[model samples]
Target: MVFSLFSFEKIQKQNTTNIPVSVIICAKNEAENIKENLPLVLEQNYPQFEVVLINDASSDDTLEVFESFSEKNKTIKIVDVKNNEAFWGNKKYALTLGIKAASHEHLLFTDADCKPKSSLWIQKMSQHFSSQKSLILGYGAYKKKKNSFLNLLIRFETFLTALQYFSYAKAGSPYMGVGRNLAYTKTLFYEANGFIEHMKVRSGDDDLFVNQVGSKKNISASVYPQSFTVSEPETTFKNWINQKRRHISTAKYYKKSHQYALGLFFTVNVLFYILAILLLSILFQWMYVLGIIGIKYVIQTIVYYNAAKKLKEKDTIYALPILEVSLILSQLVIVFSNMISKPTHWK
Candidate 1:
């Protein structure tokens, strides 16, 4: 086993690592957020990086806002589209332009509305980029203290989302990622034809892209706190619902294999619980439902609670129950809306 041991050590040392990264933000009419969060981007403590913002023809002062910062900071470059580039109106089109302008080989993406929660966000993320995988997943959370039950619900949704991808990537089956805090190499983008197939859709530039690059070995995640992308949660339920519905519109295009995996997981678990509850009176069988919920939720939370502590949001656990309940309910609504009409535009 001496030779075998030497080869194993060689393979272990070959794990993914840090490389220069260009964080790309696509903005449209985000003057307020651009001003508030851009400094956070410019102030990252990392040694080597650049910030490229694609001003997707915002009607607001977004271009002027970024112009001031770009003047002082050489790393920040703003690409302005005349609001007439696509004329069809899609965020992915703006993102594609941003990718072309990026100076580095690795692209880290977030929205103008998002701010990195930690200075080490880049370092934590870059550690996961390797030749084995072209993509790395990062977490994005709702901004702090944004609401009551609604805010908690939003955070919980984010938490469980973190759990699903982070855990599943470790276990081998990768699903999707939140665009607000994700990274991939420039080479990977071009190799995948860089979102050309899904360009027409308003959403899924992130999800669809991940679907295309899905692989248990190649896909990876950084669940640590410093790498998390934190942004304002939707202030109103109507607004949040609208944003979610737009996101739901992209689900129709997910790969059939990914769709089957998700459907089986969710349908099987949900159906078992519903059946147990129906037989609760005669069999007390629903007691088993509580056990399954407790175990899965706890194990999931424990993993993420460690992540939250790292990210400095230990208090997020308080929102857990509300988030889970709302997630189950809202998904049904999203599924129904998906059937009616394909949603477009962000309200």
Candidate 2:
């Protein structure tokens, strides 16, 4: 987290740049979201870009919404996908068709339920691409709701996850990137054979693809708020936990080095709290334990404060300690729950 705070840099948007990009959005029953959010995508300030809307066998009016937009906007291209028995509930197959339909080499991806924080999102994300760098990782934030504990918890977890991935990418060990605001070239997607390696796993259309193709030299982290995408947080605890279960189940497919690094960090934090609580209950080495815990909190607060400001989630700073503890406990429950039963399909 500290490393990301100091090392993360924003890419300057170029004037008179002509890199054509295809903004791909795959929706499964996202009619309401597409109606509300797709205009912002269609109205982006980039010079050359097309919007590829993939109606992934949506049962709702999602395809109708796409047609409504495509009728008026010439740049909007719609691909209607049917349910194939071979890849019935697989998001990967839908995304592959969308990628193939994209008219440009550079592609930016976001969820149907997400909207860019700034119109310069395309310019900001695509600016980092060069001869060496193909993957651009942007932070995905959750919308804040007043007087909602779950909303705050969701935002804090998103903030911390960004800190870890951004810090790791900055430290030359790129691990994962969120699809809510991630971008890459069409050439790289095909070169890596896309998501074929993990197509059966419904949840990793974003991170697992990054884990397979991301390298120290080819991936860049974008910390600018102009590049951010915001999505609605799950409204209920049960829904959020199920959503997390699907995501956490993908961790096992990550490279071994990343598994160890991420696992060690999580294990150390979980143990830190466990040991602190045990020692406090027993009143064993009371003063020393309190001092160490105090020091850790102080450092964590400082790091999280700076990171929150950069990511535009500073509202979460006041409840950092509480949110961290709650998130840790929730993640433990999610891991155990996934072990007992596999996570559900992507949708």
Candidate 3:
């Protein structure tokens, strides 16, 4: 089957003199990550852009690291939020401050733990913005470590998430974007009131805000290799599960249409495997059951391989079958966990 829905047109570089970009990053006790990743953002090849780092009450040497960078690089701006009882563990507030501090109209956002895939990251991402488009969604991939089941599963899950969001954006029904490599105009944030409604929630700094303000006509995507950002994956299963739980909590706040769409997708995915297993158990229909399963697998492999290639995740194609099963289990666990408890920390 042809996967035209996930196909993306490459973005050509354009003269960006009139469109200076501001890159915002929110860091909380990310001293080590900042030491390694901040320079990549500061050294971007874009002509006119500033890096705004929000040092959100880092007890570690994160503030010192930001100060060290600011001393040499004039483009580096810092907003240090001191440890306050009122603003403890709130990334949305930090991000809002960073946006307000941004000097340029076009704003790009990424986390302190993420590094751009190329020096031309800003230039590539900014090219998608025009007079009409206000939002730009880019791909954020995790670094591929040693060949292992957990690593492959993580990469596969990331690829599938990108596939759904990117395909939906291409289909003109944009729903969400990852904050690790997402960009939008400062005007869009201000006009949308800047996450005021979901301030109480720990997460939703990225997906929730986009769901509220994004539309088919206003949002564009940048899937070019140069525009992507890469970040370190959670090394332990406990950390990864917690991260997924925090992310799942934000789904409840999505628009009704988006909720329905994602819900139907997950439901169909779970049911597909369940029915396949049941049909395989019936000896009389073994041949037909195996054929059906084979056909579905072939289609998935083709679509996923192409999508993975475009996103620079080609190595993950080999693990699609196992990853798909693990994804269903992960989804079920996250759904059940969210029902019992909500994530309290944004970190």
CA lDDT for candidate 3: 0.86
Candidate 2 lDDT by residue in tens digits, 198-290: 888878999999999988889887777888999999999999999989888899999999999889988998999999899999986799889
Candidate 3, which segments miss by more than 4 Å at Cα?
Answer: 1-3, 8-18, 83-86
Pairs of residues at least 3 apart in sequence or in different chains that clash in candidate 3: none
Q: Which stretches of candidate 1 lie above 4 Å from their native place?
A: 1-18, 85-87, 281-323
Question: What overall lDDT goes with each candidate model?
Answer: 0.75, 0.88, 0.86
All models, RMSD in angstroms = 5.6, 1.8, 1.9
> Which residue pairs does candidate 2 place in steric collision?
none
The deviation in Å at residue 191 for candidate 1 is 0.9
Which run of 10 residues does model 2 get worst, by summed lDDT? 2-11
Pairs that collide, model 1:
143-231, 225-311
10 residues in a row with least lDDT, candidate 3:
1-10
User: Rank by TM-score, descending?
Assistant: 2, 3, 1
